[model samples]
Target: MLLILLGVLVLHLIILVLLLVSTAANAWTIGSTGSTDLWYKCLTTNGGYHCLPASNEDWIQAVQALMVLSVLFCFFSLIAFLYQLFRLVKGGRFFFTAVFQILASLFVMCGAIIYTVMSPDRDVSSSFGYAYVLAWVAFPLSLISGLIYIILRKRE
Candidate 1:
């Protein structure tokens, strides 16, 4: 039981790292030109290519904020999980850990949903490549980890 809980905690941490990296890469790509800092000609003039400047900076900022929130939640959840493990050994219930886990999952879900609904079509189909997929993948793993935490119990 302990090992399983530990493994889930590790998975949650991995998902958090992946989410942070994906967000940073995406922000860089959206904020810069293909190879130069100059405004991407393709983005500013034409709309066929993926390396286009964002149509809405506000949307980008929102996504970035959500990503940051999600990362924070994941980090806190990790700490809570570790603390819960120690408490479990001492025969304490994991009320707080479970709360943190659920909250983290909710934040990830919100971030993922916002990206899915508000993201420009061109960015996902053309610009982001694997980065977009990675963000979506992190969502489920984080949610799974939270669910595991909710179900976890110390065995005598």
Candidate 2:
């Protein structure tokens, strides 16, 4: 059971990393450039041609900052959870660690939500892809991990 929990935790971390990387890529409009090219040629609807504007370094930098902070929180939460797993005792440490982990998850979720709500449609490049889906995926996993931490008990 412990191993299973550890595996889940590791998987959660991996998804977090993927989320961070994908957000960074999205912020910089990486593959979106080629996507824009294809979109312009293949899909020309009533809403003009779908071509991404030139990269905006400033916007990218701002998004990167948010991503960096989210990543940091995830990393810290992972470490704290692992530590609590090892040092699981009926004490204040357990509660504190669990609280921190949950807060970290909340922070990541909030940042992602903000990005989604505030981000312009053109920033999305193509309106269809796995990147957007991945963000949604990470959101739930992180939330689950936080919940797990809250319910977790030390079986000594």
Candidate number achieving the greatest lDDT relative to the actual structure? 1
Task: Compose the digit string of candidate 2's lDDT tens values, residues 1-156.
Answer: 668677767876786676665554433212434332111222345755455543454543444455566567677777777777777775323455456555555655665565455444444444534555555566667667666666666664
Q: How many clashes (backbone N, Cα, C below 3 Å) per candidate?
A: 1, 0
lDDT string for model 1 (2-117, tens) is 67766886787788788777665633234233321112223333534455554455655566677777777778878887776766664555666666656666665676666666
Q: RMSD of model 2, in Å?
A: 6.6
Candidate 2, superposed: residue stretches over 4 Å from native: 26-62, 90-94, 121-125
Cα displacement (angstroms), candidate 1, residue 146, comes to 0.5
Q: Of the candidates shown, which would achieve the greatest TM-score relative to the real structure?
A: 1
Worst 10 residues of 1 by lDDT: 32-41
- Global lDDT of each candidate: 0.62, 0.55
